[model samples]
Target: MKKTFLKIGLLFAIVGLLAGCKDPSSEAPQSEGPSVSTTGESISEPEVVLTDEEHNIAVNYIARSVPLVIERTGSTIPTNVFRADAEPPLPIPELKYGNDLILITYGELKYEDEINGVYLYPEYTVTYSYLEGENYASFEFAVDDKGDDYAIPDYPRYDAEYDSGGNPIHTVPPAKAARLYATIHIGERSTRFNIDMILHPQEIIYEFTLDEARAQPMGKIVKVYGYFNGYFADWNNGVICDGDVALGLFKINDYREYMQIGKLYEVIGQYTVYHGLPQLQWIKRVTEVAAADHPTIAAPEAIVVNANDFAEQLDIGNELSGPLKHKVGTTVILNFPLRYKKMLDRDGNPVEPGSLELGKHADVVLTGKDGNNFEFEVKLSLNYHMGIDDQAAFRDFFVANPTADIYFTGPLGAYDAITLAPFAFEGSLSLTPPVV
Candidate 1:
């Protein structure tokens, strides 16, 4: 977590000065506008334009006081309020009268300035409005971007840790300060003020099951409670299962090394879809539950489907519903024995048996009991259990057992078709002639 400290002393001093010296009835120049009186007669309401000094005072007062009010009232400021660069930026929340709301209607990064010939800080324009009634009065401000007429504080930056790839991780940038010039209207009188304040990121974590997490809109950060199902492919990626439903976990933090298989754990990350498979990416945290507190949970059982019915099982209307849809991210076993056909690449192109390389895959075409052709990928990787030294050894086995019965057990992944990505060669793949 990153820490952002607001200068309370300066803010309170500004607030104190404005509270004592500001006049509620002091009216600046009025803009022409139609207002209905008690008698229904039209009149102009004062649209006050405050002087430089008055504008500065009002801005400072609001900037200092609004945060206190928000904290005291337990108001939730919108997360997208400070994100000027969000794609299809979320709508600023509508203001309601009773709540202490700080509505940021518009925000943008405007300029960058160098400080003491070292650090560069970016400035932003934050236009906002708040309602005033019995609780508080309404005020609107549109601060100009040009010149140094108003003081805009430097945006704060915190030290962030970087990954081996040199990408910053576990760091959330602080929102930049913007110039604020506010016109406060109370009854028939109005005044103006200006100030600058820093915006902090408010992260909201939602607890969900694996099914619920997958149903969430893409790119949503969610926390899921489930049992760690052990890593597949590498230690950084694995699956977490809640009952029969599971989600792939990728790029998890260091805590993954301590995660025990089949243990109840809370995992937090962003929900994403790679190809057609739903997975949790950029895993932020993983915490194991105490065995005494939680009843021991076993790993989810793999749903078995015969090879002849594999295609039909996955043939739902869309990816969102049906029997196999629930099994998309979960484990599955292809039970029926497969008769070997021909080896091909992912694109169905055949290569010489001697051409396959280590850590590379070739699709093995096989015939199911119903004589329907299905593709099962075979990756030639380090398989000490099978005593296979290289791709040559894999080729010799396939050549010797040209008509072997094959069975696959692994998580069902999808691309052009539903496929099995076996994590291990020993248990995940079986040959009729056996590995020997």
Candidate 2:
């Protein structure tokens, strides 16, 4: 894994800091207004999906229902205690509640994917506060004890779990869902909010089955988990996974390096179309999860086919148009004798050593039994996509032994179906010398 946890690992320290500041006052504050219930009962029916207008109204109501504390900061009301670093801070009314309990101004609607469906919830910012003067409390936020003064509090920071007596306690739930509740304490007084979240089954692409993913609606957010079956082109960032269902990943840079061939991971991104193929775009998160065992990556199934079948699969125009097109992005071995053809750059020119450009593709062809040929492109920059220089050693060995059988394994370039074209990338090319 490419250190996906390295950055997230730092979040634990922030959790520890919040845990140490537990409310010490024995007398909890008396909550005024409609008290939130902790009873484990559904406010809405199971599988109820909220419409966009209803979701807006519900979110506004929840934000307004939360308590707000007013304090004098030079007669200016700042929205929240946590402020981003800026020069000569401007005047804004500070709105907060009991001992920096909750940040109402920064309320945001968030989603969580669960076994049943996608759950919606609200996220509020929490800060550290202390008694100041006779009746007021002062607050400060930070990235750490160093008092950076611009730290953002982590989500689900408020307690949502229950104790043995059924009293609401602070703890992260196993799965963050839409219809969840949070009970926060301001001094001795604790208040609970029963949040009925919006349900969007279609928006949650991670919940898609293999068949569902293929036909999922476009223009939605996806938070799905699957085994990292490595990448497509070594050029741009792309990942292939199979689990809960088979899916593809794209435009995820932060956690791409950590992705391994067989490790399980939860990826969050926007669902969109790329090059006529369905893929997750603008990936927000790529988190590793524990799986029973590494997923078994099956080798590409070899096949014997006539020229027409090969051409139809290699043709991009027919991709995803029907089942007749080859399966793109799948590994396939071509047993046909593929000559050592020249590599061409994006403009279709011969790419000499160091002449290869980034973001451009190189094409290679393989002739079939019917005297027909198929061509495929490889992005020269991607480590997975090998260049002529990369094959110098292997090419030399082939020169010393002309009749040796060679094999290559890699995903096809066509956006839809698997193709038998050779993409000389790393771990895709091999030469088994003739048996003695």
Candidate 3:
């Protein structure tokens, strides 16, 4: 069996090598988001994927997806806390077969076979360092998969497991999804991602299975919190996590505009146990912006990002105190998830749905509002024929204005980044200084 696996692996290695290293500048569509394609390229000489060396490429890739979060800032991911009675269950689209709490504890380098969907990875212990001000809160997350060198949070016997769909089961119910901020450390290198969140109310609907959606007498809207990066924003932020939430992610354009990897935001998602992972469903984005003090903007050699139609720019000064001024109505949209109903149909449901209108909201780091994060429904029309999801378009949704600030978010707080929620300013916004 080992030899056969090796033979197949060797053949795949050759094919992967033949695929060649793709051009870095080349762009492709990503179902995950508008990010670059992550297909591994082949080198002239295919290197052995599983290296005896600790912390290899496989580990790094997984780490990016499964972050080593530090809750030095807060126990919950969101600072704006709502009653549990309000939100729905977690992992709205439902990745696995069981109602297990799904948690994405961490990611490490692993060699995966495209044909078999198998991952060969190493094991490492996960630990954390708590900072001051952030209280400690115990959260639950099950390690669905662990490797020879990898040890999952709970499962003790095997390195990994498979679901009915044959996909790898990796989830951890976010124990601290309600935290205000936390500094996480992963692996020996202290790999950490600082996550700060503020939870609030939103109109999220995640209960309708595909079949049930069509049978509904009327459009059933649910409410949840609005999540946005940079908790420092003065207004409410986050998305509604109603309905088959994952189905919602598919309906928006520039989904990354609503969310990203290394930043702070308020996630108003449903708190449910999917495959043993605690997760919040984001229906709308109260706001979204880059990190403050990050090298993406702060470098003396910083180059402005832009294009005729769409592009990103960096400010040498404080990211707070203003919005990254662009065109009159330039909006970044996220493709949140939403699924169809699962109700019984005699003749089966129609082959096509309204392209699956997923829950969506604009990416805004609110300049002004009462809550740190918020998401409101606005009348939006889509020109799906024009390659744009109406939900992704910018609408006069959030009432932009500034008052209080959610300090749990670091310097690049939305309130600090934006002048007002609706963006009402005659002149340029004032420069924001770095937080000490």
Q: Using TM-score as the measure, which candidate wins? A: 1
Which tens-of-lDDT digit does each residue in 34-120 have in candidate 3? 111123321121233343333344444444444343232322222111222225622101112112222223233446667866556
Cα displacement (Å) at residue 153, model 2: 18
lDDT for each of the candidates?
0.49, 0.40, 0.26
| Every model's TM-score | 0.49, 0.43, 0.17
Better of 1 and 3 by lDDT: 1
* Superposed Cα deviation of residue 266, candidate 2 (Å): 2.2
lDDT of 3: 0.26
lDDT of 3 at 317: 23
Q: Backbone collision count in every prediction?
A: 10, 28, 139
Return the number of clashes found in candidate 1.
10
Worst window of 10 by summed lDDT in candidate 1 = 146-155
Q: Which candidate is the best by lDDT?
A: 1
Return whichever of 1 and 2 wins on TM-score. Answer: 1
Ranking by TM-score: 1, 2, 3
